[model samples]
Target: MQLLALGINHHTAPVALRERVAFPLEKIKPALATLRSIWTSGSPEAAILSTCNRTELYCAVEGKASHETALEWLSDFHGVDVSHLAPHVYALPQSDAVRHAFRVASGLDSMVLGETQILGQLKDAVRTASEAGALGTYLHQLFQRTFAVAKEVRGQTEIGAHSVSMAAAAVRLAERLFEDIARQKVLFIGAGEMIELCATHFAARRPAELVVANRSAERGTRLAERFGGRAIALSELPNRLHEFDIVVSCTASTLPIIGLGAVERALRARRRRPVFMVDLAVPRDIEPEVSALEDIYLYTVDDLGAVVREGNAARQAAVTQAEAIIENRVDHFMQWLDARNVVPVIRSLHTQADEIRRTELDRASKMLARGDDPQVVLAALSQALTNKFMHGPTHALNHARGETRDQLLSLVPTLLRQPER
Candidate 1:
């Protein structure tokens, strides 16, 4: 089987297309099962890494057409047209797959360059795959090394230094729209890690009122308590939406939680007062239509790209250093993958040798049962075993002509030699 990395990311596709192909957190395990079922040729192994910026499938599949097979599975599962997706999708095989995994884990592939959040997201994906029993030897080894390379990159280089996190960028954007964050009421929709990070950043600015709206009251309460804020049910958002001047949302909901109608109602209630909004979710918690409303400033994950990429130029040296580290690690991983590919050949060779030994022993046993001379039989058995073991190589060397014979002449002694102390 060959290793393949297939998906579309922010670099290759717009958020509209990306959100369509994204796998929700709860859907990942079942999606993995479905993907495994689609490839009937071999015992295919797969792990999916889905985040705000990308949704990637790392797979170990058999056959020459595995890449196309992966693309078809993705298209069918997500219900996206092949024509719309084929241009944006990248299917990386073998070493390219290894390299991509390493780069992604090391934060080189993030929208926010060198941001550490994608690494955590990747780990979560790997853990989920492990729980679903979707991981096998190939994927298991790939992620382990991917993590190690990330740790090494972060430890040895300044790739993450001077980076503007998504949270900080959101705050920066909010400041641009409003006179002061301290005077604005901030409403965060969701209690996931991204929400928590945004809350921490916004809380540092001391917003007048901080509220967390979530589907789960318990999780919202816990998150709210951490930031000295209050929690409310997501259902209550429409009634309370006008009270907040800033809204930031990141939720796992497949559909838009905040519709244009709700925002329009909120705007009417506020009497044309501007609301700066950030939607950090993949599928998006806030509606795309909300961005069109007058006096409303809305930004999606892609809209925040410019703010995140601000300090990247200054860190170009560090990026160069990180790239060097990833290259070395990718080479090492490919070497391991190459070694793994030959394992069956190694097993077959050992099996052949064992068969020869067993056959020679059985012949010697038969001779002893017939009352043959013990020393003669023993010598004959030894000779027979050696001849049988060497027959293939001896025949090949004798029959081979020109360059092939010359090659065998140089290789035979080393193949036959025992290790020296």
Candidate 2:
């Protein structure tokens, strides 16, 4: 079996391309099921990890064809142009795939270096795969080890130290737009992990008021209460949109929840006051056309890229330490995989030995029944078993020449050596 990872990430593709290829949280399980059907030859197992920065497919397959099939499947599913995508895609095979997984889990491959969000994202992907029955032996083992390596890296290094996360970056950008973060009223659209993180960062600055607008009141209230913010129903956004100076939206909606018309109405009520907005959703919670309006500072997921990149030089030392740890672990994982290659040969050898033992026992039983002495029968049985066991190796060694002969001579004795007491 072989492991393959194919995808486009923030490093290789622009946000425009990455967004087009992204899989929604609900679509991932079905996407993995489709990949399994397409890669029938290998009884293919797969997982999809799609975040703001990446859309990756990790597959466990058998032959070279699975690699090409995976790429075509992704392009067809996303309806993206392959010619434009091919150059931006990275298709890693075998050891390279393993290394990529380790780096990703360790947060070394994140857009914001050493960010922990991707680890949670990766775990979610694995869970989706497992629920879909799409994660087989190879992939399950890979991700389990990936998580272990992630833990070791986080525990051993300062990789997460001095990191400027996207949530913090969003807050930083809001400070530039407003005179004081403490004086502005902030609205968070969604009660998901990203929104909660953004809420924590904004709440720390003591915003005048904070509100969470979500479809689920229970989830929304729980999140808001943590930071002394109140929850509001998403349907109430149209009437409440004019109340806040800063809005951060990151929901799983496929279409824009905050359309141009809604913003225009909100703007009219505020007498065209400037509002700072961050759209952290992939498909985007806010409409793209809203960005064209006057007195509005609108930023999408891509805008935070440069913001999070600041002070990365200080993280390089920790990155080096994490990479070293990942490299050593990857070597050990590959060695375990390599050791599994001889399982079939070992099974065949055991089968052959069992067949010999049964045949000899049958003959010895007949001899004893025919009134042969027990001592004679036992002697014959032992001699016969030994000769049969040695015959194949002796013949191989005698007929083999040069390197072949030397290998047999060394291997046979080791295979038959006595066990230690």
Q: Which candidate tops lDDT?
A: 1
* Candidate 1 regions with alpha-carbon error over 4 angstroms: 62-65, 398-410
How well does each candidate superpose onto the true structure, as a TM-score? 0.94, 0.88
TM-score winner: 1
1-421, model 1: which lDDT tens digit per residue?
A: 6888999999999899999999988899999999888778878889998888998999987665377888999999999999889999999998899989989988898888888888898999999999999999989999999999999999999888889889999999999988889999999999999999999999999999999999999999999999999999988988999999999999998999999999999999999999999999989888898899999999999999989888688778988998898889888888898898889889999999899888888999999999999999999999998888878998998899999999999998888799989
lDDT of each: 0.91, 0.89
Candidate 1: lDDT of 275? 97
